[model samples]
Every structure is written in structure tokens, then in C-alpha cells.
Target: MAAVVHRLAGPALLAHRDGIRAVYAAAFAEPPWHAEPAEADGYLTRLAGDVQRPGFAGAVALDGERVLGFATAWTSSTPLPGTRSYPRVTAALGAERAAAWLCGGTEVDELAVSPAAHGRGLGRTLLEAVTRDAPDARCWLLTSVRADATVRFYERLGWRQVTHPAPDGYGTAVFLGPGHPARAAAVLPSL
Candidate 1:
């Protein structure tokens, strides 16, 4: 079955919370964000909050009744929120440093697609939904350096690597904006 991509608007945002949680859980299972399953609900709630925010938005691709993929973002005067990690995620891009990127731009809070739903253009669709509306958005996002495929994917979509080494002892990519010129430089693969 083909996945139907839609904007979760109005109160429908909250209705799809569980499905978003399921998608996130499956996507973040790899390094630097091996989150405990219990935290899934909290993450979804935060995403819900972003959906309701005036300038924030999100999109999801549903394969039948299940959420196959999703992307969530917000325009803020602040940088991305810092993640609480055991032993501290990394010294390079700590919470405070990570938050700094939020200045003067919109942040890609989270973008993930379930393994089963890979190869479709859903991720780009979700990104476009957030960016198309905010033409002034200074595109920026933070992702683990070790997540090679994710890094390559974002690079292909025009996000850049602004951070030196990832905060979690891994490197991270800090995108400048969608379709930014810096993205043309050779992508720095994870060491």
C-alpha cells in the first residue's frame, strides 16, 4: 500500500502521538540516542507541543494506519533543546552549546523514518513542509556523527556540518539551511 503523507493539523496532532512514538522508537535505536523505551511518550508529547506552537510544524507519512515516518521542526529564538544523556552526551556539543544553534533560525527538532518505510521521499516531504512555510528559516539540525546514512541523507538535502566533533564522543552535523551552498563541500564522513 502507498503511504499517504499528511499534515497533522488542529487536534489531530495529538491523535497521532502514539504512532509518532512508535516511529521514533524504531528510528532512534542506534548510537548516541539509544533511548529507553519509557521515554518515548515524553518525546511524542514534546513533538505535540511543537505542532501546536505558532511557528512550529510537522509532517508524517502513514502506511495505511501506521505512521511510517515523520519530521518535526520549530522556529525559535532559541537553538535546539539539549538532550539529557548519561555520562553527558559529549563535551563538544553539550546542551548549552546545542541550544546556541537555535538562535536566529528554525531548528529541525527531529526527523525519522521507520526502517520498513525507507526509500520513499517521505523525509524530504516532511522537511519541505516545515521549510516551505518559513522562507526565512535559517535551516539547522544536529545529528550524531556516527549515523553515516543519516549524515549522507541530510547532506543530500542541503544541511551542513557546523560542529567539529559530535558532543557524544561522536561527530555531529550542524546544517546551515536547506539548500545552503556549504553543503556542496565534500561531506566529512564519520571517523
Candidate 2:
């Protein structure tokens, strides 16, 4: 069956809160330091409210009404704006730095496609949906060091690693948006 991707408004997200959380929990059985923490049932309900705010966006890839993959993003009001910050944003990015980094751009708060749906480009498709919808916004995300495959996947899509596993920050790697300044030397044609 063909996958149908739908952009979910805030209220709609609340309506499918459980499904959204499922994606996060499954994807982040052990996500990176900077990446948000896995969601609990309660967190799922909280997210429904958060994603409804201005500058927020989310999408779900469905195959005949079943969620196969999902993505969500949000706008920031600080210096280094991002979509949404989760897990422990302050600890992951350094308290002061976290707020600075998430001030304006559209952040890929969460992106997950089940293993069963891998290789079908759902991750990329969901990403494209947010980016396309927010042409004026910069995009970014935090991913784990262990997620080697996922890292390579983002790189192929024009994202650049801003943070590394080092003393100053969580072992997490921060990926900048498409064509971001840091990505100047890392551009590869999108597939």
C-alpha cells in the first residue's frame, strides 16, 4: 500500500497523541544525548499541546490509516532557534547554550520510521514535508552517536554535524539545517 503523509495541526496531533508517542519510544530506545528523551504516555499528551503552538509542525506517514512513520518540528524565540527541545535540552546543549540554540529555526523535534518501513524514504519524506512547508525557517536536530546509520542518512540529505561527542557537550551530535553555513563543505546531492 502507498504511504500517505498528512501534516497534523495541533488539535489533530492531540487526537493521535498515543501514536505519536509510540514512534518516539520505539525510535529512541536509546537515542543520543542531545536528542529528546523517549516519551512516556504523559509526555505524549504534553506534546500535543506543545506542537499546537505557533511555529510548530508535525506529520505522520500512514499506510491506510496506520502510522508507519512520523516527524514533528517547532519554531524558537531565542538566538539559535529550533523546533522543539526534548529529553534534557539543557543538559544536552549546556543550560545557557540550549536556549540560545533553539531560538528561531524549525527543529526536527522527532523523526522516526519503523524498521518495517525502512528504505521506503519515509524519514526523508517527512523531513521534506516540514522543510517545504517552512521555507523561511532554518531546520535542525540532535541525534545520538550510536546512531551511525541515521547520521549518515541526515548527511546525505544536506544536514551538517555541529556538535561532537566531546568534553564540552553531550556525546550527542547536532545537525544543522539544509545548506546551513556549517554545511558549506559538506554538501552532497540529495537522492
Candidate 3:
């Protein structure tokens, strides 16, 4: 069955928390994420609160009633809360650039596709559906460098890697969305 991507927000997204958790568990259990079921449960608990944030949005790729994949995003602000990576991203991009580029911009918090859904273009469809109407079309996301396929996937979709100051923990790699103002400035000058 061909999967169809649907944009979701507000109560609609909250209503699919179970489906989202199911997809996340199946997707992240693979090599890169290795997330436990408890972790998915914890994420759903956090997502319950995240939906209340301003500009929260999500997209799901569904084959009929079954979720094939999903993506979620929200607007970011200075001193981004809840994760050490935010500080590292700020430090890497600097206060001025980070503010100009990321603050108030959309941040892709999660994008996951079930292993069974791989190579079906559902990931790309969900990604575009979730961020298509982002503020100023600016969006960003972080992923582990170890996830070569994941990194390549984003890069293939025109995302630019920010190559300055290395992230401190977990080898996180940050990417600027296509057409972002900071993308051109964030590239390290060749020696």
C-alpha cells in the first residue's frame, strides 16, 4: 500500500501520540538510535507537554490506519531548554549567529521511519510535510555523526552541515535547513 503523509497540529497530533510512539519505537530500535521502549514512553510523556508549546507541528506517513513514519517540530528560542546539545549548538554557532539563525526558527525535534518503511521516500515526505510552512522556511535538526545514512539522507535533501566548533557530547552533528541564512556563514574556511 502506498503511504500518504498528513500534516497534523494541535489536538490532532496529540491524539496520535500512541501511533507516534509506535512508529518511534520501531524506527529508533535500529542501529543508530537503539532507543528502549521505556524511552519511547518517556518521549510520549514529554511530547504530551511539547504539544502545548507555540508552533508545535507534526506529520505522519500512514498506510491506511497504520503509521509508517512520523516527524515533529517546534519553534526554537535562545537558551533552548531540556537538552545539553542546545548549549553546544549555541556555542558552535556563537550567540549572534545562533540567535539570527535558530532563535524563533523551526527545529525538527524528531523524524523517524519504521524499518519496514525504509527506501519508500516516506521519511522525506514526512520531513517536508512537517516543515513546509515553517517560519521564514528556516529549520534545523541534530543527529549523531555515527548515523552515516541518516546524515547522508538530510544532506541529500539539501540540508547543510555546520562544520565549525565540534559538538561536545555524543558527537552530535547539526544541520541547517536549505536556504537558511546561517548555512553559508557556518561553513569552515578551508586551511
Candidate 4:
């Protein structure tokens, strides 16, 4: 059965928070992220503010009433906002490339597929839906280098891993979307 991808924002997202949380918990509870239920609950509180940010957008993949996966993004500009590894990303990519390739571009803050939904294309669909209208299609995201399958999933979708060393304490690998200026000279190493 095909999962229906719905583009949601603002109030609609808030209303679906519980469904989103369920999917988030299921998706991140496995290897790599291993996020706890409490962490997933914390995300709901954060989501309240995230949806209010400039250009906030999200997509949820659903099979009937069950959430299969989701992706969220928002526009980020200079200074990169001081939250949740943004500073690490700026440090990893250098202030110059961060401002050039990421600042003012769509930042894919979260992309997760329930373990059962893996390989069903829901992750890719949600990612594309959330960033579909980004200016110049400039989109970027971060994932754990240890999550080999997740890294390959994004790479397979044409997201290029930026060559900069993963910043300490971040444990993340940054990726640049196709056509991103910074991607021109970056090496695509398998994580």
C-alpha cells in the first residue's frame, strides 16, 4: 500500500503533533539515534516553536491513520541561529560556505522513517515534499555518520556529504543538496 504524503504547516502540524511524535519515536528508537521516548516527547515541545519559524514546512507520510514517516524544514539565514547543532554545522562547513550554501536556504531539520517503512520510499518522498519549493532547491541536512544506512539513503537521493570534518560533539555528517555551490569540490566518501 502506498503512503500518502501530506504537506502540513502551522496549526495543521500542531494538531498532528501526537501522530508525528509516534512516528518520530518509532523511527529514532532503533540503532544510531536510539532516542528515548522522553526525547521524542521533548521534540513535541520544540515543534511548537519550530512551526512558527520563517518558511517552516513539514510533510507527513501516512498509511491511513498511522504515521509512516515525516520531514521538516525551515529557512535559515546568517548567524545560523544558535540551536541544536547549527553552530557545529557552521564550524564544520566554515562560516563562509555555511553562509553561502546554507544561510538563506532551506534546512531539513528532521527526516525519519519508521523502521517498518524503510525501503518503501517514504523517507525520500517526505524529504522531497518538504523541500520541493526551496529557492534554487537549496536544501541541506545533517545525520549521524554512524547511521550508515541513513547516510546512504540521502546520498542515493543525490545529497552530497560535505567534505569538512564532522565537528566534535556533533557526531553528524553534513550534506548539501544537488546544485549547491559548495558541492562542486566536495568529496563523496561512503560513511
Best by lDDT: 4
* Pairs of colliding residues, candidate 3: none
Instruction: Write the residue-wise lDDT of candidate 3 on 81-124 in tens digits.
Output: 64658778777777787788888889998999888889999989
Each candidate's clash count: 7, 15, 0, 0
**What is every candidate's alpha-carbon RMSD to the true fold?**
4.5, 5.5, 1.8, 1.9
Cα shift from native, residue 69, model 1 (Å): 0.9
The segments of candidate 2 whose C-alpha lies over 4 angstroms from its true place after superposition are 30-38, 79-102, 135-137, 165-169, 185-191
> What TM-scores do the predictions have?
0.75, 0.75, 0.92, 0.92
Better of 2 and 3 by lDDT: 3
lDDT of 1 by residue, 1-191 (tens): 98887766636756778888988888887666787777787887676566776567677788788898877776655533345431233244455644443454566778888877888888888777766665344566667777888888987986767556554454555666765433444255478
User: Which segments of model 1 are wrong by more than 4 Å?
Assistant: 78-102, 167-170, 180-191
Pairwise TM-score winner, candidates 1 and 3: 3
lDDT of 2 by residue, 9-86 (tens): 777756666666666666665544232544446567667577766688878888986778888887755544332334
Which pairs, if any, clash in model 1? 78-102, 79-102, 89-168, 90-167, 160-175, 166-170, 166-171
Please give the CA lDDT of all the candidate structures.
Answer: 0.67, 0.67, 0.82, 0.84
